[model samples]
Target: MQTDPTKDIGSVFGRSWTLLSSNWIIIVPAIIIGIIAGLIAALVTPTYYMDTSGVYPVPVYHSMLGLSLVVGTMIATFVGMLANVVILTMTTGMAAAAWKTGKAMISDGMDALRRPNVLSAMLMLIVVSLVLSLLTLVTLGLAGLISLVVFFFLIYTIAAAVVGGFSGMDALKESFEVAKTSWLTTLIVVVLLGVVAFLATLLAAAFHFVPFIGPIIAAAISGVIVAFFSLVLVGEYNDLRGRAHPAVAAQPPFTAPPAVPPL
Candidate 1:
């Protein structure tokens, strides 16, 4: 298999950085939502202190676990998941705009959150999480390799939904088709992105002790980092879709639609 110059990992990585640097404002919505989510979490969760007995500072809860605690935990989990999906979809919209027209707008990101797109994204998230959890259990906590393969193939699901107007399972199937044709490139991008996210988490953790603003600062850092990751995914998705390949032949060829109309 010959490598396409346009799909070179270095080139794609460089272009992603260029887009991120030029369109840093794309992260504004993410930061805003992150802060809001952090505030909600702070208000809902029980107070705790860090226990330093271990090498890591483990959270120690003083409050007894009860009905309120369970309810709060559920609420926090739901909010966190919704916040992530929103950030991802918004970033996908902005990144597609940047890739297609050399400019990105927060409105473009908001526009991408149409009912069908949001519903599809939410379903995909739930299904994927369940699938991965099952795989983890079946593999006895050794599902990392299988999970990586799964993620590499489905990485473009949001981008496809936002850019190609695909939805639900169609979006996931489209991503898998595109990924298989460019397996090497997609896999490399996946591994690189995983590294970036890991590093970003470490960087964000450093802000955890800054008093009242700590969680806010950490949220902002995480939002920006994940937004960059989403941008790169969009870039790769567009590039892969633009090419002619047998893998995507069963469906109508992807074109840059004038607008992603609300459902």
Candidate 2:
């Protein structure tokens, strides 16, 4: 058992690629999802550029202070926080759906998509992301780390919600319980993934000097990398869930202990 969370980074990366390849039909739809997201993002470029300077105030501080400096700072902080919440929520939901869809393709072929539970899982994912984002803000960003710990658990919960027919919040709570068993591993994975994502963005920016083609290429590459990493994180979440919870093991059938000889 690898104690270091970072140690599993490579393994997760390899597994993600393998999973994607093995379930290409499902993976293809995931890529399509990415492309659609990217297209929407692209379409909003002008609006984003125009609103770059706009900011919203932080709810609490904004109401308390009337000073110009304080107001400006609060506004910027609020906008930044809100934007992050929205973007993360969208991506997380998409990633959760993609992972569940991929697994379904591998296990039950195309028929898996027909299940109503699948749509429910995707819907619940968006809600979870929103809840997590607000939770992070309430904790003054401390929940960022907590978010990492529950990262995979959330995905697994989404899968369970879809497959086992669990309620969204119930599945989320179950994931948190399972994640607690391997919190350290989860932390390391989160840090390493964060580093990789940052570096990928930096590299993508290097393409900006190429005139007309640069920005487009950069956007496409960055989008793909983002999509790939999102899937990897979700895959890792699935792996961790099985490892942390014996009842959810993928191998031999898990049997419940006989009801303790009635009291």
Candidate 3:
């Protein structure tokens, strides 16, 4: 069994920032792509309002199935699938770069996008999200508390999928091991990232109220959020892998001391 490498939560964050800064060239474009995909997803996503008080206006439709809902669902599902592919491609590309060179690149990002397994990763993302959502509803919002504790483990799945080409189940299993070994660190990082993400969100919301530049800034913030969070996972994975398989020390050669010539 591979030993756990993660030791310091603070170091992980530092490494993540280092990686993100080093890969700014690639991350910038990737962030833009992420923003665009998000926009597309929003455009296609189903929108409906329900009211038990009968105060809301409902869409007019003749069919019992509600044509608007059917069409919206189909459109959203198709667009969402495509969007998932795009997003995973970007993330995996960064992960691949991190694995290979401890850095990131747009080209590496593009290459990773071409891999077939990114689809599997995307599927895993969707499935896990749905499961979590259902679990949340079933538990009457209690799952939110549970997720606050274990959601960090999901980052491992993404790392496993990208770096090792592991399938969803394999990623999940491996993630559990990594998470088990570094639970405290994971918790700390997750909490910190959550705070950062929250701050970014607030900033984005503030920017949303600005003029034209405000929208652009908000979009940029969204992309930054995605890029930073994903990059941190890459850093953590690198740390974990290093700890598990440290470099072997080379054997020292025997050397003879110079003979005394003064005698």
- Report each candidate's C-alpha RMSD, comma-separated, in the order given: 7.3, 10.1, 9.2
Error of 3 at 105 (Å): 2.3
Candidate 2 vs candidate 3, TM-score winner: 3
Clashes of each: 0, 2, 1
Candidate 3, residues 48-136: lDDT per residue as tens digits? 54545654444332342367566666565556555654665576567557646877767776776566665576677677766776687
lDDT values of the candidates? 0.77, 0.55, 0.66
* Model 2 global lDDT (CA atoms, 0 to 1): 0.55
How much does candidate 2 score in TM-score?
0.53
Candidate 1's C-alpha runs over 4 A off are 2-7, 47-64, 130-149, 210-217, 242-263
**What TM-score would every model get versus the actual structure?**
0.75, 0.53, 0.70
Alpha-carbon deviation at 64 in model 1, angstroms: 7.8
Question: Any residue pairs clashing in model 3, and if so which?
Answer: 5-243
Off by over 4 Å in 2: 1-9, 18-114, 131-156, 159-167, 250-263
Residues 53-136 of candidate 2 have per-residue lDDT tens digits of 336545534444445445454444444444333333333345555565544233342333344554455456555666777797
Order the candidates by lDDT, highest first — what do you get? 1, 3, 2
lDDT of 1: 0.77
Per residue, candidate 1 scores C-alpha lDDT tens digits across 1-263 of: 53564446677678877888898878887898877887898789866545456744332332343555866876776677678778888888888888888789988887888658656865787668667766777889899788877877888889889877788888888799888877777877878888988988987788898898887788777767877887788877777775525455456856896997899
